[model samples]
Target chain A: MASVLPRTVQGPPVPLRWPPEDNRIPREIFTDPDLFRWEMDAVFTGPVWVLVGHEAEIPQPGDYKTLSVGAVPVIVVRGADGQVRVLVNACAHRGARVVEGPRGNVLKGGFRCIYHMWTYAPDGSLLGVSLPDDFPVEFRKEDYGLPRARVALYKGLIFASFHEQTPPLEEYLAELTQGMDRVLGDGRLRYLGSIKVIFRTNWKLYVENIYDGYHVTALHTGFQVVRLRSHGGQRLVPNYERNGHLWGQSRSTRREELQPVLRDMSLFDVRTKPTTDHNMMVVFPSGVVTDYFDTIQLRYVLPLAVDQTLIEFTFFARADDPEDVVRHRVRQGPAVLGPAGAITLEDAAALERVQQSSVARGDNVILKGTPKRFPPYRHVDEAPIRHFYQAYRRLIGVPVEEGTP
Target chain B: MNNADDLSVREQAARELLARYVRVVDDPDRVEEWPDLFADQAEYRVVTRENLEAGLPISVVCDDTKDRIMDRVTVIREFWGAGGRLEDRHYNQVRPRHVVGPVWTEPQEDGTVRVVANFVVWGTPTTDPAPRLLALGEYRDVVEFTARGPRFRSKWVVLDTPVLQDVFVYPL
Candidate 1:
């Protein structure tokens, strides 16, 4: 909550190229408190859609979970009408956070603000304010109902938009779902479990890292184990791209991606047949969805500060999967992607190292091995990074010259 | 030894083994000795209390066998070998009580004793001001009664705090 700043306090004009070229990002943007403020204004609050929670998480009616989009608290609840509602968690009366902790089922009288006892229904309707007879004449109870953001649900995943005018979630993700990356398989996703960790790095760095195909074979330690057993001829290509959404495809079962302890041959055999492939998707701003091997993980990134990022990783098992498959997901999900994932741990260390060095005056280069305007799907191309930077530049408040991206 | 004395000896041995377990885990220089502390088929995990209560199948460190534990040690040696995560030391001091309801040892005919103890481990990272609480939880340990000494058949680390900072490269 401390990360969100007032809109009035302005900072110096950013001293750099308006639209950075050659896949270069000004290092100041990584460390500048002012740019972070503008990011809150333009990127987060301006037409950006945030993925709040999946319906499976708040299954029962009256169940609610607390989340935030750039420090603005939000409550994702299931109403008695059986529709999931996304409401601002701040109390309308005194601005106190109405929901406590991460999640819970609503008690009697809906949710009561502990600070002033103002109550609200599950549908975000105002129930009552404390000592209503003593209120001023102009104050109407109906006028202060819990303010809600525009909400949309696609395949059980809930998305909320804070902007006054943003496209629907489906329209926003139009091009990508047609090809390359598509998951949430047949709309029967089982809610497995969750874990969160704070990285000592900028939030953008982690978001870009998600669609990264270049670094997988090099950085993640577990990949080496799988590669050793996998058929050595596998290749990765930019499988799909559109509207700030990008994904890569490669064989999910190259050598049998085996965990030494829990042997699930299916994970290794997923892509061996022509039927399946691994997919990584990044919905602009900071919603990452991945489906590879035996697990489906949703990466929710929260920008806490210029130098700190909070990442919540939630894994899901297929609803139709047997107990063995679910157990396999529990064992193997973290092995590849969570806080304790083999490659994820290394990524955290490398990101923090960059955070320490990023404060200096410099250009963070992304044009490592690509010459194409949109880059390619090769293991070392900067295409995904370039794709993200374009969306970021267009959304940010600064003016850009003609033909920037 | 008689019944009372035999029980005392077993408890004393269990206590010493538990201390040695912590000492081995805390020493970064002696990482090779970690896998030896457990039996080959040992079950090890570092899980959140909430996940445990909700029956959620997720963990910070979930290894069903000692081979996976050894793999972690191998990663520290090769993957994060030179300069991986922040340099740190662990201070694990087990607070044990004499005969208690939840902690009574059950000796098995298969040469194993099930012992449960409580522990609080502190971490002193190079960047932190002082030692801070890393994890505080109960250890549901299965100690084998071998002639060579007590070794863990399984050790479940159920942490009360779910949220953790950065990476959990090292074991809890």
Candidate 2:
């Protein structure tokens, strides 16, 4: 339970109590600078795992990619010792980012800070200081190693946590990783590519949209028209399993109609069914792995500000996938996954409007088989949203009251 | 034994044909000409320079088949127009997707012409008075002489920038 903070005697900005009992979220959560800082401290940089990249992305020893966990810049690198490490990108001396661009290979002497020529090993150990001989007598070289977060991996997707008390990735994911297993069957994911874009909305808003199953048909009507008309709905099932994890299994029927010259032959694994197997799994905080109609991918999100979020729709082709099949999968992934993706394109418009309109006084109600009333959920049910809000409330240190936003 | 007049006539004809094609592709009012610009089995892909250089398969806009290109038109008219977010662009309500200037054309050998053009697709939201550049990319094209005169054998829109402001509801 979240400990209640003092009310009415506030000098600082926290959550408000106006209408206090409704699931109608206060607009401040999406726009306030104070709330963003608090969430960075209490939720993102706190006891939570941030999904960054995959082991294959940095297959070489010196290969590295820069990413962000919350607002903290991170460098996911494979060290010379064959270990994947997540080092803070800030230079130990001047706080300048170590890894400059998105990613590159620095095999020889770790990362070198262009600002002051402070070099660090691939494993984040301090290596050289150009003006080292003139520092304080008590300045020890060993104490200046790059700060690192705890790195972990499930299958091939890499994740890291800032806090030491954060539970292991297995425990943090709970039984949710079981669903992830199906998506990453055998875990031999070949890096296809990624389309990176920033959403002009809060990162939390984008994460919540992942679990908002209700918006599938209404918001993305064109896609729904295609899917429902093409594939006879094989019953959309939502897995609101505990721990803020969500899994959805829905089969598409339009396989034969839209079959290209090279179709998806379930090149992934024997466990993956062709048209009948469609699943989307969202890990807590901001990682989404979706296996839609034989095209598998992950959506990694990073928060930049209260009203901005950077996201990457990284599509993959299995290592053993046939050449033509890989081409087909590539065509399929971006068609419906990223900024220029299928239904996602329309979704961006609606989501931006939601953020833009959150400045006014309003309370949005969640009902109609929402999480508060599950057990008899339908394809059109909003139950997953309730599950998200419950998890969000707990994570954001907001008191959990039934039927409250 | 090469005649300057013959070469001048050929170059003028090629440039004129390319100029006509650019007008049809660039004008929002003449977007209906998109279908006629492609051959029966043509490929038009709007991709990033990075993907193109790497020989990657994915694209921002991939319309390999003639049907997919037609689907883009039908989908835009039927789906995007019916009453969704695109309607919210109050600044220029007629059609938000259009190409800008700098349509450069170069004549190539064997009845082919290489073409290049830069464009910015804007999404003028009703909330803001100014129109936002949704995507800025150059059209890398290879036009050839087909049965139906000059047509787009393939057009690859190589977007210089990585970010596309919001949605790509229309042609790049």
For model 2, how does the per-residue alpha-carbon lDDT over A200-220 read when each residue is reduced to its tens digit?
A: 888877877766667777766
Error of 1 at A227 (Å): 2.7
User: What are the interface RMSDs of all the models?
Assistant: 5.0, 5.1
- Per-residue lDDT tens digits for candidate 2, residues B1-172, read 3655544554555556656665665455565677777767667777766666655566777777776676666456444443445454322142464555576666676666677777777665557656777777787777777777767777777877655455666566
Kindly state the fnat score of candidate 2: 0.28
Per-candidate DockQ values are: 0.38, 0.35
RMSD of 2: 5.1
Q: For residues A292-389, what per-residue lDDT tens digits would candidate 1 score against the true structure? A: 66668887888889999888898887677888777778877876677776557767766776787887868877654446555445544556676676
- Model 1 error, position A250 (Å): 1.9
Top DockQ prediction, candidate number:
1
* Worst ten in a row by lDDT for model 2 chain A: A1-10
